[model samples]
Target: MTPRPLPTSPAPHRVVALLRPPQAPFPLACATEVFGDHGPAIPARYAFELCTEHPGPVRTGAGYDMVVTTGLEALERADTVLVPGWHQPPGTEAPPAVVAAIRAAHRGGARVVGLCSGAFLLAAAGLLDGRRAATHWARAAELATRFPQVRVDPAVLYVDHGDVATSAGSAAGVDLCLHLVSSDQGAAYAMRVARQLVMPPHREGCQLQYAELPTSGPVADSLAPLLEWLSGRLDQPVSVAEMAVRSQVSARTLTRRFSEQLGISPGRWLLDRRIAATRALLEETDLSVETIAGRVGLSSAVNLRRRFHEALRTTPAAYRRAFRAERAG
Candidate 1:
């Protein structure tokens, strides 16, 4: 099959999720929410659809059934072909018919995505050869054992290679899907979609899955107030001690709270906020780097550039130019 270009038709780009039973619901839900209809306020850039190998009532492992009306033929028109979390018995290969369809679809030019254990299907299809793929951490070893040709990095959230992509389990699927939207649509638009989903700008795809995350225990209260305070003070240099004082807690206690609730020290959180502010300013304003540095509480433009590169691997000027196009489009 000759590979074609990405979808550029006047119609909305089509996203088709390929499902097999017993299907996991969370990864499917991630794709649906990110690509599904968003009402009149947001222009539809993509059309979300579903298909199955057998095309009938499929058991959702989460205790429900979804009736898929389309068969694998859906792959033919898909701008992006996605396989949501796959859950066959361990060491069991994805059905040969499904594997052939995915391989053919990719060869025919549809971008292929595997979320979570769906990487198993892509591996079976041989799309992951010579590529670093990500899957749920628990299954990483199994995937490596089965497909030594594929470099399996079980730590990252997702990996996108333009033509093919895979994500770690669960919510990381949301990150990869949003990354696609940011690529196909734009960052400004992806930000709007993120707002609708009530999620942070989907984490960077390469972010480690084992990185510290917010804790569920009620050992510490929510940090909403402190975050809000810090957001308003991004223009000023506020030390961690000052933040602790404002929170009415000792610095030691504040540090502990940050670790328990946010999985990072108060200082890291503050610096992240500054970096985020710097990005927003760079993307939205015509301000010079020196001005943006002062606004985000950095000592100099050089410091801002170094930190920006460390975070995103891009300079502020280049990012601004790139996202300016994203925003304008």
Candidate 2:
């Protein structure tokens, strides 16, 4: 039988997820739930499917089997190709055919994605070489050791390279998928999907997988009240001097405490919090950049843009457009 031609129009993007033996079901389900067709109230934005290398029953790590009919040929028609999680035994390389198929799909203009340990597959395919990528923090060191060419970032939730993307651990896959939806359709649609999934509309890809909370001890305990105060005053101009005064400690002592407990200097910690606040405001509200800057204590829009771009590698305007719902005429 003759195969139908792939859609040329960009709407309803085609997503082909690659499945391999011993698949981890959670990440696979994350991709499916985000890209799968919902009922008519929310129009279908993605045509999602699963494809295996050999086209048959694929074993999952969750002790179940999924029958896959499509093969690599499905990738030929995909706008995006996702690898949820590769076969376990973290060091094993993906089959040569699977690697080649992924490379071919990328070459043919599909945006390739890897979730969790699936990043090993993209690295093996040469897609992540010389590029920043993320995987489960536990396997990040091994990915770096095995590949050597990929710049592995174990801290961030995900890394998107326009043509290729990778996410850390199981749930981070949902963040990456929602990002894809926002990129392809718009933030409005992505938020709809997120609402259905009962998830935050967007999580900046750069958010730390695990926040650096202050370690417990006398010094950390003493500074807990000051930290709570700082959290509430993010919209005001704050300084290490003020913090030290509030904590009744010398500047040097406060600096030492911040470094020992939070693994960051006081100023750096404040800046990180401001940036995080800016991102939340950008995603959830329609506030102007100037207002957001003031709200986050960055003070000026110009400085906010500079710091935001320096930190996230993208401008606040672009970030807002990517995650904010568009207004109707």
Candidate 3:
């Protein structure tokens, strides 16, 4: 009997993860866990590599140096190029050569990702100009000051604008990698990757990092119970008046409480939660768009699509397709 030929249509994805001097190990690990070579037991789809400005050893932030045999030349043919934190001090300029390499890769149609402070490099390279990007909160102000051309949204975990993407610091890098997995393969693939990494399958990048609201002067603990109630009822429309009644407080008092604690209006908080729930369902379930809409308390599929597109910059259908493709691959 003759041996069978391998399938030809689905090519492996090529990802080049750029490693700067004094690189942040966590973000690099996040990229590796998501895309690096795994044995046949793992059902791998990506050919991931770690590349540096020079084909030599690069220092890691963890006080050790690792050899990176690949150089910027690797990015020339990559489907995606990820910068996992620039590793430079806050407010410092990125090297022009590094910036040029990133720009050239992106210009050649490779997707560009800036995980954590890597966003600073992307912005410095002028790729993030007039685009929404994010960075570690501690460096957010500095990034904004240095690159006024880019819109800095420090709160969101990540922002994906097709060819260019950026994420917040630390663990948020995982979210962005998962997002890339989802985008390149599909939700199922992304979920499987997350499972292999032992991480949550889906988290709306826009979800607040901490559920705890900014606290003011001490007051009643009533808001805590109300929040718990809201959390459980995210699927249903939650009105400010209804929340006030449930908390046994006047509408005005409830509004003040939410503003003081959450730093956002109660209505905004409710919408945010609903959107987050929608994201989870979108990335985890095989439900229809209309069904997801109802489950997330949106008015209809139309409303969900509109709001989701506005918030995430891609339609639910497109997002689903990306994840599904990754999984299937």
Cα-based TM-score, every candidate: 0.62, 0.62, 0.62
Lowest-scoring 10 consecutive residues by lDDT in candidate 2? 210-219
Give all candidates' CA lDDT scores: 0.84, 0.85, 0.81
Best of the two (2, 3) by lDDT: 2
lDDT of 3 by residue, 239-314 (tens): 8899999999999999998877766788877777777777777679999989988888887999999987666666
Off by over 4 Å in 1: 1-9, 211-329
The model with the greatest lDDT is: 2
Q: Kindly give the stretch of ten consecutive residues in candidate 1 with the minimal lDDT sum.
A: 211-220
Q: List the residue pairs that clash in candidate 2.
A: none
- Per-residue lDDT over 230-328 for candidate 1, one digit per residue giving the tens place of the 0 to 100 score: 878887888888988888889998888888776689878777777778877876789999999998988799999998776666688877876776566
Question: CA lDDT of 116 in candidate 2?
Answer: 95
Better of 2 and 3 by TM-score: 2
Model 2 RMSD in Å is 8.8
From the highest TM-score down, the ranking of the candidates is 2, 1, 3
